[model samples]
Target chain A: MSTFAEYAISAMLIIGGVFTLIGAIGLARLPDFYTRLHGPTKATTVGVGAIVISSVIYFSTLGRGIGIEEILITAFLFMTAPISANFLAKAAMHLEVRTSEKTRGQTWDQ
Target chain B: MMLTALYITIAMVTLAALLNVYRLIKGPDAPDRILALDTLYINAIALIILLGITLKTRMYLESALLIAVMGFVGTVAMAKYLKRGSVIE
Candidate 1:
């Protein structure tokens, strides 16, 4: 209910929104699947993390004892994003999916 | 104001979801499609959380958590299937 919390949430929302949009842009426009992978796992993860943190702050400021369940979503997302990215990357490599000509390290090691 | 920020975030997340759909449709590779799908679900979670924030409630987070869990599982399964042509051995 304080002004500080309001401003903080606003800033976080802006930052998260921008990062999420950037990640989506990268995913859509990147030339290679591998390059595109960098966007969502890193930037989008951080973006959603910020958004969720802001939500936590909002609820906690409302005298709700810090709604901790949303944090679980962030944690679970952070934990699994890399695993999914790893799986996707490995599968892409195994399948020899086409990469941009500029993309290096074409060797499938493993 | 909180209302403005919330609306902005909602718009941005919705746009991100649309982009994910674009990638899902346009991706030339299976892994690329899988990646788009993964991002789409994540965007969905973000949207749901934003909705909860707007409505001043926490109930939506449960669905967000569920989406997170299921999306991860689905991504892993699809990637595995693409890798070995079988989801479970």
Candidate 2:
């Protein structure tokens, strides 16, 4: 691989790794379920997307033709993550999970 | 340089997975645990893809894909069961 390609892949990997770590930290430390939801849905999805795109570039440059699998997974992930998050939040609401006092939304009755 | 970056990324992703596990174990609510498991699967997918890249093989891709499909289904099922009393009703 060319130096430019190597550099690009490295940068993508690093960005992906950093965002993933940040999202995990947010997930672990956030005060409530709703607030924690923000982390994995937004940050981790993008993080995985970036990393997969790098993989696509790497494999394509390796002369085996473009690997469409990575792209497909990224798309699939983007589609499913929000749906799962929505339902999980709904479940939390149904169960009357506690929310932090600083949270602005009023709790819903089951 | 590339090798070093890959090693660093792997370490960071592993750490992320560990944190997710911590959340999974320490959840104060069921949905919290479910969310942690969802995030953990996603992190596992990332780790598999990274390993594939590092080892320069495509075999890991299929496993990653399978995990993605199963993880989504599992999350949805568990979420439904949590929201309602049963997964199918």
Candidate 3:
């Protein structure tokens, strides 16, 4: 409700929104599937996490007790993102998704 | 000031979601599209939360939670199907 709280919320939202946009841009522009995977997991996770934290701050200061629901969502997201990313990477491997030649890595089972 | 910032955030997030849609449609691979789908849902959750803050209501929270759960399950299932050619084996 105070000006400082408003500013804090605004700052968090801006940071979160910008990172999210960058992640989506990476998704659209990256040449390799594996490279594309890095965008959402890294940037979007932080982005959404900040946004959720801001939500917690906003609601908690709104004269209510601390909010735990948003925290739960944030925790859930952090947990599942890596698992999903791992699965997607595995699927890409099984399907033999193309990789850019510039990619350098130890030999994978082909 | 806060309202203006909220509006800007909503615009930015919507643009991001649109970009995700472009990747979803233009995917050069199945996993690329799936990744786009996954990001889309995550963005949707962010949007819902932002909207809740803007509207000062808690009604959307449950839907956001449900989306998170369902979206993760869907991603895992689709990934498994892609990896093994069937979801259940």
Candidate 4:
């Protein structure tokens, strides 16, 4: 019989795979730097989080107790990714890199 | 059954990694490339953990943790550099 942990791991992997795929698609399809930044930051955060949760489930089911380390990493990732993205976006603006017409129409600062 | 699951996860991760590489190469600008690199590192950490599970080794988890830590540092440094034209500033 498949254990709950196995099922959980399967679900996590599937979800993570979907998120990764979406992030990749966004990266490929987004028009510009700022738009591309939005893709991985949001999608991959959830994707990686799901994978880490799956790891925790699988390890705990193996009687390894709760693996809090993955949790810590997840927290760190969630907190840091946005700040990095914001910093990058600000840097791009500071550098006066050109933006797409779509972005310019959406925001006046461009 | 477990082996099959492991293989599938690995394959998915490998595909994601390849996609990230494509983004890195095709990026028209430096910031876009940096964003791709950030994604790559996060995916890499997850891959390391998955590999650890497949290999039944705790060592890989430790390395994965290190990768996560270092990846954050690398991204932050890169972003700072892109912003100020210098990592130290």
Report the lDDT tens digits of candidate 1 across residue range A6-104.
Answer: 999999998999999999999999888899999999999999999998999999999888877887899899999999999999999999888889966
lDDT of 4 by residue, A12-110 (tens): 877886787688778878787778888788998888888888788777777878877788888888998898888778777766666778764443233
> Could you tell me which residue pairs clash in candidate 4?
none
Q: After superposition, how far is residue A26 of candidate 1 from its true place, in Å?
A: 0.4
- lDDT per residue for candidate 4 within B1-89, as digits (tens), equals 55666677778777888888998998777877888898899889878878877775556777777877888888889878877678884
lDDT of 2 by residue, A1-110 (tens): 89999999999999999999999999999998999999999999998988898898899889878877787889899999999999998899999898899878587856
Interface RMSD of 2: 0.5
The deviation in Å at residue A32 for candidate 2 is 0.8
Top DockQ hit: 1
Candidate 3 Cα outliers beyond 4 Å, as residue runs = A106-110
Off by over 4 Å in 1: none
**Fnat of candidates, each listed:** 0.88, 0.75, 0.76, 0.43
Which segments of model 4 are wrong by more than 4 Å?
Answer: A104-110
Q: For candidate 1 chain B, which ten residues in a row score worst on lDDT?
A: B54-63
TM-score of each: 0.98, 0.98, 0.97, 0.90
